[model samples]
Every structure is written in C-alpha cells, then in structure tokens.
Target: MFAPILMSSGVSIQLQAVDYLILAVYFAFVIGIGFALQRHTRTSDEFFLSGRSLPGWVTGLAFISANLGAQELIGMAASGAQYGIMTAHFYWVGAIPAMVFLGVFMMPMYYGSKARSVPEYLKLRFDERTRAFNSYSFAIMTISSSGISMHVLADLINRLIGWDYTLCLVVTSVIILLYVLKGGLTSAMYTEVLQFFMIVFGIAPLAWIALRDIGGWDGLVAKLTVTKPDALHSWAGTSGTENAMGVEWYGILIGLGFVLSFGYWCTNFAEVQRAMVAKDMGAARRTPIIGAIPKMLFPAVVILPGLVAFALTGDGQGYELPTKDGVPNYNQVLPSMLLHYFPSGMLGLALTALMASFMSGTAANVTAFNTVWTYDIYQSTIGRGKDDAHLLRMGKYATVFGILASMAFAFVAAQYNNILSILQLIFGFVNAPLFATFLLGMFTRRSSSRGAFTGLIIGTFAALLYHGFSHAVENPLGMKGGWLAQLLGQPAAFTLGTELAQTFWLATVAFSVTFLVNLIVSLVTGRDKTDAELSGLVYSLTPKPIETHEPFLLRPAVLGSLVLVVAIFLNWYFW
Candidate 1:
C-alpha cells in the first residue's frame, strides 16, 4: 500500500521482518509507559502535571518534542519546497521572539502569579467572562486540532498495517486516551523521552539515505543549488497581485510571520500549559530556552526530507508524482518518501517517526487540555467541591472525551482530506482573538472581562469572515484562466487556498476590531479592576526580579537580547 516512495533514484530498501517487530515493540513500550505510570496516579495535579516533578532538561526536551508534530517533519519542508526559508519565519520571527519574551516578561508573571491556567490568569486580571470565553474557545480549538493529529497518526499507522485510515485514527486515539486517561502528563512526559528518540532514530536513516542519493553533503548542495536555487536561497517569497482581498504577497510575511506568531506563542493554552505545569520557577523559566536549542535545528531534520523530494521532483525523476489535486500535498510527501527510500527495518523505524509526532502532539494536548479543565473549568465551575480523586477522575474523563470527539472529527477530516485548510479554519476562528485578549490582559490592567469576551466573539467571527471571503476569491483563481493560475502557471503554482498569510490577516483584522470594542466597552462601563486588586494574579513579577526597566549586564534579560541579535543576524545573512 505504501511502497512507491521507497523506490528512490538507486537506493534499495532492506530488512523486511525485523524492522516491523521493532516498530511493534516501540508501540508496546509507549503503551507500557501508560500502564506503568498508572500506578503513580493519585491526584489531578500529579496526573495532569507529572506531579510537577520533571527537571528542567526533561521538561525542556519534552516541550520541544511536543511542539515538533509529525506534520512539521513533512509540512514545513513541504512549505520550504514552495516558499523557501520564508515559511521558517514562523520560527525565526515568531518562535525566537516568543521564547525571549516568555523568558524575560511572560514567564515571570505566569509563574509568579501562580496561576494554574492562562485563563485563570485572565480571570484574575479581567473577569469570569474572560476566563469562560477563553477557556471554551481554547477547548474547542485544541480538540479539533486533536482530530487532525488523529488523522495524520492514523494515516502513518495505516501505511504499515494496511488498516482503514479512520480506523487507525480510532485505535491510536484510544491508546493515547488510555495512557492520558491513566496518568495524564506523567505518561506523556515520561513517555515523551521514548517517543522523542524514536522520531530522531527514524529520521536518522532517511537523512543518511537523502545524502547518499545526492552523493554527500557537498554534492547534494551543489545539485540542489542548480535545481532548486530559489528554494534554498531567499528567505522571502515574491509578492504579486491576486492574493486574498487583492492584497500583495507581502501580506503573508506581515500576517503569518508577525501577528499570528504573537498569538500562538503568547496566548495558546496548549503551549502555555507546559509553563504552568513546570516543576519550579527555575524550570519554568529555563525550559523554553532549553527546548529552543533543538527547535532551532528541528527544521533541518523535519523539513529536509520534503526538500529532498521537491529536489527529486525537479530532476525529471518525480514528474509521475500526484500532487493531491495539484496543490503540492506536503503532508503526503513524507509517506511517499518513506515508501520509496526506507529499507524494511528502516521502514518500521520511519513509520515510528510518524507515530512519534502524532503521539507527542496528542499527548501534549491531552495533558494541557486536562489542566485547563481541572484548574479553569471544573475547579472553578462544575464539580467545584470535588475531592482530589474526583478531580483526577474528571481529568481522565476529560481525556477520554477529548480523544473520542477528536477521533470522530478525524474520521470526518479524512473523508474531506484538507488538513491544512481545516487547521487554518480552526485556528483562524480560535487563535487570533485569544491572542488579542491575552496580550491585552497581560499588558493592560484596565482591560475588563467585558472587553475580553467582546474581543473573543469579534475575533472569531472576523476569522470566519476572512476565511469565507478568501475562499470566495480563491475559487475563481483556481479556474483555468484566473489571475493566480495565469501568474504562477504550472508546478510553482501560488496556491490561493493555503497562503497562511491571508488567514493571519483575517484573524488580525478580527482581533483589532474586537480589541477596540473591548476597550470601548471597558471605558463606557467604567467597571474598573485595579492592578493592586489583581496583584497576585496579574503583575506578580518575582520578588527578586531583575528589573526589566534597568537593563541587566549578565542577566537572562541580557542573554535574551544577545540571542535575538544573533537570530536577526543569521536570518539576514542567510536570507
């Protein structure tokens, strides 16, 4: 079923039986972690946050593992095939700044305030409505994202077992749910160490194969330079008319790179939950930067395979490949590549790589989602008087519910088969406003609950509208003689559908309008909450805090500044 991609230029895939056995053992190992860790589960906090017991390095590595999803290995590289280094702006511009900002500014406040969930912080800073709005919206987004994860994971597994893709999703989701249901973060974090290594091991062989195919690093670069010059050279993509709302291509840079970056890193509950669950102030403070080290190199591992495939395509060797309806299905490229290049034992290993991503992502969500529900929803709302066991039970129930719903959604998503589009739609509706509300809540004490809720509804609708109109415009462009079709022509086609920038813009506009609305409502209602009243929740910078105002000489603040400068230099030099 999945053999075509392995038949690369000349390499022969080997190891038919042993590889699959090792792969089965790998799955058994992860499941065993879940059951083994089950004995330690006692309370919601222990289950959901690994008892806040992880060291800085463990949490840091786990954090990186969680963030680098299965799609990232393929998706970003797929983007690189088309957009070059520009897509990495999601990392460079968005990720680096967010890491620094979190370390210097956000982490201190979150950890110091001792808030359990980011929305709990919001409630402290704003109002109950703010908490409720953010919580519900975040829950929906995360669950839907889980569905996509299920689809990808299921597809990867199906490639090996010849099972129905939707069935694969259901099985994988059930396994994750059991572990998550049993021990939550303990299972996730402890097992993340295993899943993380599996991914690296799987990629190791493929990278070797890629280099071998091109005859070594120098030869690969030289051949690639001639064939995919633009793919390697520029950090920026060309701008032209016929983008969404007639906006130029430059909008992608501004919207996806800048606006969306702030939202996801600063506000998203899935990522923020990690910081909240950190073992101590030190771990919370250092884990993100620790994670960033591997993350910086992640693109080289995750994206290079697709680039290899893209390179192969240009060489007259790949013309036979289908393009998922001619839209350059980056998601499928990894599977296709695996089928073509991996030897038998290596094939099991490559399949495991995909499992690593799927498991890591879903596990991260299961833990994070449970945290939000426990601290934000259940503790504060339903089952408020429940005992620790009850809360722990509820969290497990939440994990089950989360997985079951996502499996159903995954099945639906597979039938539709538009992972990126569904992802943008889901995030566009959820992320932009959450980003706006959180930023406002963090920076402005005057921000009211009314403001946050108002912002939430407004931001969500704006994204929907943006997606709606953008889709409308895109339909004509997909036609034979539309502006986009004519301009981009064949192969290097500027897909109107997946331009991430347009989605970001839609979210941004919605965010801006809703933010303005929140401000006006706050001002008009004049229901004020002073910073003094909210001190414990909002502005609780460390008692031993290094003054953000007075620049530190040898401080983390100083190191952060140094890092940003170096990142900027790298981008420019490489751009």
Candidate 2:
C-alpha cells in the first residue's frame, strides 16, 4: 500500500521501498522530539508559552514556519499561477513591513507586558469585554485555519498517492495530536524549527529543477510573455484593474499592505505567540525580525514553482495544470510539480516536507487555540481562580479539544478551490477589526475599553455587510458575497475582478470603519484606565526598550532595518 501507483488523475510518480524508509524515519524523529520534551512541560506556563525560555533563533524559525503551512505552500503557488509575480505582493508588501514593525515596535509592549496571548494583552490594556470578544473570535479563526491546513494535506496525499482522504486526515491528525499532547508548545515550536529546514530542503530543489527544465529564468520569462504578458512583471499595469491581480496601487497598498498585512502579523496570536515565547524581551523583539529574513526570500521557492508549472503547460510535452470541474485547480500546482519532478528517494523527502508544513501550521494553530481557550476563555470565566496545576490540566484538555474542533472544520475547507481566498475573508472579519482595537488600545491611553469593544462589534458587522453586498465579477452572488445586494435587488456596491481583490477591499473597509469608530467612541466615552495602570501596555506610557547592551548586529532595530532594505530591493528588482 505504501508503494505509489498511477492514478486516474494522471499522476505517474511511484514510491520505492527507500521512499517508505525515509517517511518512517521522519515520523520517528518527529514523535521522538515530542517525548524528549515531555518532561519540560510540567506546568501551564511551559505547556502554553514554552516557559518563555526559547532563544531568538528557535522562536524566529518557528514564527515563520508556523506561517509557512498550507497557505504558503499550496495557496501561494496557486496565486502565483493565477496572478503571476503579483502574488509576491503577499510577501513583499503584505508580510515584511508588518514583521519588522512587530519586532522593532510592537514586541517591546507585547513582551514587556508579559501577556500569554494576544487577547490577554487586550485584557491588560483594556477591559474584559475587549479580551473576551477577541479570545472567542481568535479561537474560531485558529481552528478554521488549522482545518484548512488539514484539508490541504489530506487532499494532496489522496490525489498524489491514491490514499483515502478520510484515512489520510485521521492519520495525520493523530500524529500531530500525539506530539502536541505530549510536549505542548515546546514540542510544537521545536518541531516547527525542524519542519522549517525540511520544507526548505524539500521544496527548494523543485524550484531549481523546474527552472532548469524550463531552460532557466530567461526561457521561462519568454514562454510566459508569449502566453501571459503580465506574468513576469510585478508592478506593470497595476495602476488599474487591467493587471492580472485585479487590484490597483492604492488598493494594494492600503487594503493589503497596510490594513490586512499589519493586522495579521501584528495581532494574530499564532505568529506572535512564537515571538512571545522568547527567553527575554530582546530575543522576543528580534524573533520576528529574524523570521522576516527567510520570509522575504521564500517567494523564489514557493511562488516560482507555480510560474514554472504554467510555463510548462502546452509546451507539447503533455504537461498540464490539474483541473477540477473543467477549471484549473491552482491549489494543486505545488504538489503537481512534486509529482512531475521528484523520483522515489527525493519524492519521499519532498512528501515528508509537505507533511511537515501541514503539521507545523496545524500544531501552531492548535497550540495557540489551546492557550487562548485555557487562559483567556476558561480561566477567566468558568475556571476562574483555578490554581496553576488545575490550569495546566485544563490546558492539556484544551489541546485535545482544539485538534478535534480543527478536524471538524476540515470539511468546510473542501468547499473552496483556493484556500487563501477563504482565509483572507476570515481575516477581514476577524483580524482587520481587531487590529483597529489594538492600534487604539496600545497607542493611546485615552481609548476607553467601551470604545474598543463598541468599535470591534461595529467594524466586524461592517465587514459582513460589505462582503454581502460586493463580490468579484467572476464569482456568483452567494458565499463569495453580494448576497445582500441580490436580496435587496440592487447592484453590487463594488464588483472586483478576483476573490482575493474582494477580500483585500473587505479588509480595508473593516479596518477603516473600526479605526474611525474607535476614535469616535473613545472621544465620547472618555478614559477608563489610568496612566500608571496602562504603563507597560500603552506605547507612550511605557519606557523605551533598552537594547544597547546587545550586540549591534543582533539588535531588533538593526535587524529590522536590514530586513526592510532587503525587502525594498526585492520589490524594486521584481517591479
């Protein structure tokens, strides 16, 4: 059964005994690391936040690795094939600056406050209402995100090797569940660090081999120019909807770059939780900046494969993009490339890497979800006044429940062809409004808790209404939005050219409404917390993080600046 065979989908790669050996060894190592770390997770703190003892580098890799899951692997390649180099905007414009901002500016407060989760920080800075809203919303988002990762992995395995989808999902989830249940967040982070290397080594070769097979960059470019003229240039024709991305400069910058990007990197607990677990404030501050280094370079391996796959199609070699329901299924591009290029030994390694990516992301989500559920939701409410031992026990229970919940959500992910679009829509509803609350909560002491809670509710509703009334021109008036428009018998408020563009605009609207409402409500409600109480949580009230003692190269500011320079250069080069 382990031996690969030809499938009805036309996938022809076959795995040998050596391939099974590689897979067995990888699974052993993953589970072994969890057992080894089991002793360290004796208390709630260790289980949830890794005892806040990890060095910058470990947390840094985990930070990026957690994000380099199905979204980065499958969704990104899909975007690259669909939109070409414009997909790089997700990294260059949407990720880098936010990471730098988190490291250099936000980490000081997040780390210094000693909050266990992002929602906990809201509680410290604002009131219980703000924290409760965020905690519930975040828990839902994390579980949904984890489910998407699970769905992607199961789909890949079933399509590639003819495994039953349900069997794949059960086996993969059990593996992830065992490790996380044994070792907690420490296990997850260490595994993420290992997975990071696996993903790099496993996937990087595909880019190089694909480029070589397509006759290098110049040849690929020439081929794309003949078929998709705008595929090679990042910024060309982006001034209006004439571009392949269906987004203009202002929308890209404000909607994606500023609102959606900052919202996720700065406030999303799954990514920020990795940084918060660092051994000290300095390590925490540098964690995201360090992660930003690899993040900026990831496009070469992740996005390039999609472009190569596109260019290879119709070259009279029988290569074609995988199709579902007579349309190109962009989500299969990366896995399809793996099947097209890798032999038995390399195939197992690459497949292991793909599995690792899914586990890394799923584990990250489960860990974050458990932490929030145990500390923010449970302890703060039903489990209030619980001792450390009780909380620790509850944390373990939360881990089990979180994974089960995620497994249930996997079926929901199957409804979409591109996972990233659904994820962005979710973020638009959750993260976009939450960022506005954080912006007001952290930056200004005058922002009342009432203001934050009120703004969040209104902003989230605004996003729902906006999404309901608008949709991409290509999508029908249904789950993708414009439902309210159809119901009201009015034209869509805005008809964009792509689902991604619609999500970006949705995020922008959410952010704008939340920001404006927060300011308005704060002005009406007046201050709630005193300056002394807000000292560590508020920017101006907090003391500057003194990093002078650290080596210059290791300083967060220095690292962030260097990352920004590299990011700018990449954008310029690609543009």
Error of 2 at 108 (Å): 0.7
Worst 10 residues of 2 by lDDT: 1-10
Give residue 328's lDDT in candidate 2 (0 to 100). 77
Q: Model 2, 370-399: lDDT tens per residue? A: 999999999999998989999998988888
lDDT of 1 by residue, 476-570 (tens): 54321133334445332233444454565666676687778778877777657765676644544235454555435435566677668767776
* Candidate with the greatest lDDT versus the true structure: 2
**lDDT for model 1, on a 0 to 1 scale?**
0.66
Best by TM-score: 2
Error of 1 at 555 (Å): 5.8
